[model samples]
Target: MAVVLAEILAGLGLLFFGLKTMSSHLQSATGRRVRALLRSATRSPFVGLVSGIAAGAATQSSNAVALICGNLVRGGVFTTRDAIPVVAGGNVGTAALVFVAAFDFRLVVFYLLALVGFGFHFKLDRRPAWKEWLWVALGLTLALLGLDFIKQGPRDLDVALISQALDAGLSPGMGFAIGMAAAALCQSSSTPTILVLALMQARLLGLEDAFFIVLGANLGSGLATLVSSGELEGTGRQLCYVHILVKAIGCAVLLAAWIAVALAGGDPEAALAAAGGSGGAQAAISMLFLALQLAGAVTVALARGLTERIAVRFSPPSMEDDASRPRYIHRRAAEEPATALDLSERESMRLIKLLPNLLPDLDRGGADFSTQERNAFWKGSTAIVQAVDHFLVDVIRAGATRESLDIALRQQARLETVRALVDTLHDFSGVVGEFETVPPLAFNLSESLRVIVLSLAEATDGGTGDDFDLLIGLTADRSEMLDRIRRALAASEAGGEADSRRLMHATSLFERAVWLVRRVAVALRPPPIEDRAQDGDPARQEAPEGVA
Candidate 1:
């Protein structure tokens, strides 16, 4: 009994490890393909549906597809509208994986292991790209071997004893609960479903028992997504909500139908009894699982707009989600260089407007966001800037005119300068915030920096050259003033080294910040009149002021 238990335990362990390894490596290997698949969803709902199905089958995990879709949505690659069908399709894909797993790989496992071993010995995994493939192959081999062990290792065990132990058998409700718990723990319905397949093959679980567990596992996979998606914000979690809704509805409908059939005295697991072991029962259950998933997917796909509305209501978009996306610049506009650059500039102004928000305490006039809110804003803004960069790159690649190229170059420089300006201000704000009582020098300097940020924003919005001229004057020749402030800080502190050091660092930040502010002003300064005349846009002589 002890030896048999040990074998079973070992097999289960190997099976779990193998499934995880295979899924993870498969996901990694298919990253680019998966992204391309996601993009294709925008082409058509049907194409997106197909892509989602392909992605799920390739990765062997629908949870992965959900996460990827959410991220892509935030990136503007997949809108919530387009993502629903794709997400629905992933259910079918995962079911496909279960069906594939149900097949007998007992003989192939040895050959697969041998091939993978030779490849590793030959150092195929040493290559950057080939490494993931080899691991994927190895994972598949381990999974097949583990499944074989799970089936064969218990083959000699007494069926009568197993029957005795399960004499009362599992009530459908109990089986459902166990399946739900297993899927939630593993975060994959396929894991629990495959285990059920193994148990049925080993005669440890009846077909009816496996049915309830598989059903529950399917439902639990959606719950597992919700359980794990705490970090996702905005429309980013919309996918998770969609997942749950689809799964919940599918489970209810399927379970109700199954119960109706049973109550009417029809055998749902009739195929399990007629077919051979291993493939037969496994395939039957897998097909049923597929049907359940397909039913939900098709239903959701049909009423996608309503489904999306329900999901969004459940998990509304957050400020961070709003900021993570670009407002003006988009890939389609990149084809027209002048329009794209104009859009990029407008988008940039939005970011500049937020610069003052970075130092909310110093800039009391602006909205006062909590630290967490500020962090979210910062991340969202950063992602937006990244999107801007990608858009600019696309414009350049699409063949811009000399004038547009020149504008692109300037805009690119401006982005880098603003990034530096924001970074310096961010550091300054952190130091000023850390002071127990905001010091006079720190307050004045921060206020000066904040005013300059606001002024820069104003300047870029068609404010007088007076703003730039004054900004240049404010940033210039602060060396003597710095020395006076340092001495005042050191002497006023009454011998505390930490205070002096912090004040000194704060002053340094102030100096760098003003310098960056000047650079930004210069970058945003309108092009010289002569250069504008040389270009065809005689109507566009005034230089556009850049924001924050």
Candidate 2:
């Protein structure tokens, strides 16, 4: 008994270790393929399902697969409908552990180690072909190692122990609950089932009892699916629910079959053992399970299609779902500083795209909106700017390589400059629209400010001259433009075409905006990253007025 228990525990450890090894190495090796697959999944439901299966199998963890699926769905790589089938496939694909664990276990550990070593060394090689081959070698090695480990450990367990444990006078309800608890504790249905099978092989329990436990195991597996479901919402959530439903139905069917066999005066254990032990029996059971999994996958696919149809019927036709936005970079990617840097850059670009949208309202004297709207806009802008700040700080503190840090510093300066300019614009808009007292000079400054902002925006977008050169040019042009607008407005007021006081006030507000815009641009440019690095103390004084 002690020997059997020890082997069982060892097998569990190896199973997890092998999976961990495979998932990490596979992700490093096949990250591109998985991302490509995710992108492709958006095009079709069948493709998504197949891709999910392949990805899940490679990762050896359904939870991770689901997370990626959810993110991809969020990222617009897959619609909620398309993502459903893929998530279903993920559930089934993750069951590979069950099949693998039914075999030898130790050989997998050695193979996985070899693959890891090869991957690490080969990654450093300059040859592209060598690198590609190395990744493939690593993936295959880990899979083979996992296969071997599963084969070795279970075969050595006492079969009677499995039989007896299964037969222990526990009610079907209690049995199901036990299975759920066991799976939850193990955090994997595959591991618990493998443990049960090992006990069966050790002669610890009869085959009839093993079958009931297997049914219980299926019920327990649904719990895992449910937990995974929480990661998704709307259609994705519904499809996950379907996964649980299918498994529950399968468990019921199997349990009923066992009862019928037992009542028919037949030895349920002998019958079950006959089915499981014989090649034909094993094949039949495999086919049954496979069919159940396939049916579940197919059902979700259909449900997803129906869901889309219903949604389109009820709601106006739209080309895209707004919820499709990438969330949660895998924390593990932080281990690779370069990858982390790229992720940070992607996030910055997302913010950049959102920033320009804030300009229209702020440009107009629409700042006197309803209190809620005004506050919302203010809070939103501040939140965005603060987010960028936090992201930059994190990049610096994360021990990012020098190249990564350089990239981050550039983003920081650009975003900060944008924020300052936006603040000035907002303030000017509010002031001009609120006051009736017009200052001619202020009106001139407002027009100049607008032109300067527009020019700066263009130059920034074009990535043209250095920030300094562009700002200086814009400032000179803006001064001239401000003078002309102010003179024209003052003349209009003098000619009695407009209210002199209101015009004067508008002009005054505009001038203030123009001055702030110039300061903000200068603040943004600072010194070039390369030059700053060369300085003994990298932090330098802010760029002076018109220094460019």
Candidate 3:
């Protein structure tokens, strides 16, 4: 018992390690491509179904595919609806694992591992692009090898004792319960299903018991996944719902079918006997597992509309979900640096546009956002900034004209300012909201901050020449104004020591916000004709309106 337990532990350790290695590398390699694939899936359910199958087969695990899909959703590349078919197809793809295990390719894993190891030894997998796939291959082979070790480890145990204790007289309900428990604990159906396959092959567990256990494993995996995903919300949670529905639907359908067939006098055991003993039994179980997954995938695919509606009902879209995604920047634009840089700027425009909502108390248009909504907007805006940052990096790497390079370089620098401005404004809003009695000095500073952010948004979004001049004027150095506000706050009879501290802190953030906004405007402000005429000039001349 001890030896068997040790083997199981070893196998599990290797299996999980291989799983992580394979998934992280594969996800890294395929992240953007998967997003593109899901976008295409929006055209039709059939295409979505195909995308899921490819993602699963390429990654070779449903859990990995779910994670890939989840990250894409989090990044705002695609919504959950676009991902459902692909996720369902991934489940169908994992059925291939059952087929592979049925063939008992235990020896093949070592040869594949050897091939990969030698490839590593020869440095054949060292190329920048090829490296991730090499790791993927290694991880995949090791996972299989670990599974093999798990299967073969039980040979030393007393077969009779194991059989009697486990499945010899196991009732269908008990078998199903055991399978559910094991799969729930493992958080995947693959291991439990494969273990049943090993049991059948060893002639220690009967076909009926194995069938129930396999079905139960599917059901258990769904429950475990749903539980684990308790923290995910909005579109992110939709993927979790799709995952559960796939397993739950498949298990329910198959279990019902089995009951109906058994009641109709379909002697499954006799059929296995006629087909030739344990080999046939193993084949039968594998096919059933495939059938179960297929049933789920098909149902989810055909009911795509219904599935989406159900998911949305359970987890409605949040403001952050919409906010986090990039509107204009995408991978395709990378080949055109000018166009990509333009898109990056447009994406950045979204950040400044959201600044008004930060302090509803100060926005000129009179905004009102719940604490939750404000936080969501800020989170989403941050995601967009990060997305634009990544897009700009790709633009720089794709090569460009000197002019485009200048724009890209300036944009990169501006991003730092935008990030700082966003943080400053977020902090400024928190501190400004702390007042029990709003002071005129603090209120004026807060309102001015909102106007600068609003004007900056308009300036970037095709604002006229006059608009640019106004933004540059608005955000110009406020060191003098901040000094005045600081003095006023220090002398005023504020609420208390805490109020005085908050007021002073808000002044500092206000100063930073103005400076950061000015930096953004200066970047947006074109170089003066005096500098442009010098053509050979380094263009280091100060922007008009002292925005330098």
Candidate 4:
């Protein structure tokens, strides 16, 4: 009995591991394409349905599809109403894998496929794309083989002993409990459903029991969405809740149907047996699963507005939902270095958007941001920068790949450049305020200062190469003009000592601001694709000065 239990556990472990491997590889191979399809094709409900189905089928994971849809909604690429249909379609598409697994393929065929996949995976000149597909094939083969082993364990046990141990027999309620437990433990509905089907095929489990188990598995599948929603809020959180609610409703409807049938003195088992035995039962269960998914999809699609309203009523926006705080970066995401880095990049971009507001407009005679506003801006900027810095450090410690580390380093440099620009803005604001008190200057100093300020504003407004180049040229012209004015002021007695002092202070601020803007522009621009390819270590190279 111990040996049999060991075998069952081992087989389950292999099955879960195989499924995880297959799903991850399939996502890696097709994730970008699936995202593109979702973005471009989700214009209407029908289009979203088709795209979601295709994405779920390609990736072999409905949860992955839901997460992608959630991200799209967060990014404003899709509305919650539009994402609902796609998420619904993902449920139907996920059912295809279970249908395929129900077939009783020869064991030798799986072994041969696994062997061939291993060979392809180890090939000297194999492409990365081919390697991903080979891994997926290998994982699928292992899962099928494991399913066979799992069935063999129960068959070896005495039927009488197994029935006696179960206590509740092969009743639907017991099956539902068992199914929900297995699915929750595995974090996958497909694994538990497939296992139940295998047990039924081995004659160790009844058809009616397997049917209820599949229903329970459907309900258990919502746990993944529930856990993921903990990290999200606002529209993203609402979308996840909608997904869970749809699955729960479907489960309730199916359970109610079963209860109603029982209450009417109908023998579901007798009906199932009359259909033909286990084979007919399997087909019926598959059809039922698909039907439930479709019904849920249709119901959700018809009442999307109502679903949104309910979700909002439950998860309204909170005070902590301030735009200044980093939305995506969180401690929960630390384990996923790639996602963490991506979040850091997004938060950095938000910080960059504040640059234009920081630049003082001298033509208007004062700074655009009031003193209180500037202080607030500084506080917000510091928080975002520190958050990104801390997040990057965690990503590095989490063992990010070299490529990802390089990207993080680039972001760090950009943040430094932003800090420098902010400081320069502060100094420029102070100088402008001091000049406001002074008398009118000789040698047209105010006009010259205005031109310099305008040029700096234009350069910092856009981080493009052209903008930086124009800034360099303007600064050079201003530098030469400053020298001429200095010489003229020295030769004449009309210009007072106070005027020369103010001119020197303004000149110092203008030069520093120009230099900071140039640095920021360089940090923002990446090396050309070909240049990066040739260098092979573009991250080590310093950002070129005055390069277009």
Best by lDDT: 1
In model 3, the Cα lDDT at residue 430 comes to 76
Worst 10 residues of 1 by lDDT: 270-279
Better of 2 and 3 by TM-score: 3
Candidate 4: which stretches are off by over 4 Å?
Answer: 107-115, 121-125, 167-174, 228-230, 263-265, 271-278, 317-351, 355-518, 521-548
Model 3 per-residue lDDT at 532: 48
Q: What lDDT tens digits, residue by residue, belong to model 4 across residues 1-548?
A: 78877877887787667767887887787755655566556577788777767766655566667776775565444567778878877777877766765666656656767586567767922887577777787677766667666756666667766555554665777778777777677766666777776666656666677778888888777666766555566665666776676677778776777678778999766654555446575666666667667767667766878977876786664322233367667654767878888887767766666655554444564446665555556545665666677677767878888998898788787777777766676665555555535445422443454455455555545445555565556555356766776676667665467656766676666667666666665555444543445566665344565554
Model 3 TM-score?
0.78
Task: Please list all clashing residue pairs in model 1, or write none if there are none.
Answer: 352-548, 460-545, 460-546, 526-543
In what order do the candidates fall by lDDT, top score first? 1, 3, 4, 2
How many backbone overlaps does candidate 3 show? 1
TM-score of 1: 0.84
Provide the overall lDDT of each model, using Cα atoms, as 2-decimal numbers. 0.78, 0.55, 0.77, 0.66
User: Please, what are the lDDT tens digits per residue for candidate 3 over residues 1-548?
Assistant: 79887887788777777877887888777766655567676567788788788776666567667666776686766667778888888887776666777787877897899989998998978787878888998988978877887777777777788788875568989888988999888877877888887777777788878878988898888778666665567787778778889988998897887777679899765553444445687788777777778899889988888998998887787788877877788777888887788788777777777767766555343357776777787787777877787777768778888999888888888888888877788888778777766677678888878777778877777665567778778777768867887797789775777888888898898888888888878777764654445555555443456555
lDDT of 2 at 138: 54
- The ten-residue window of minimal lDDT in model 4 covers 316-325
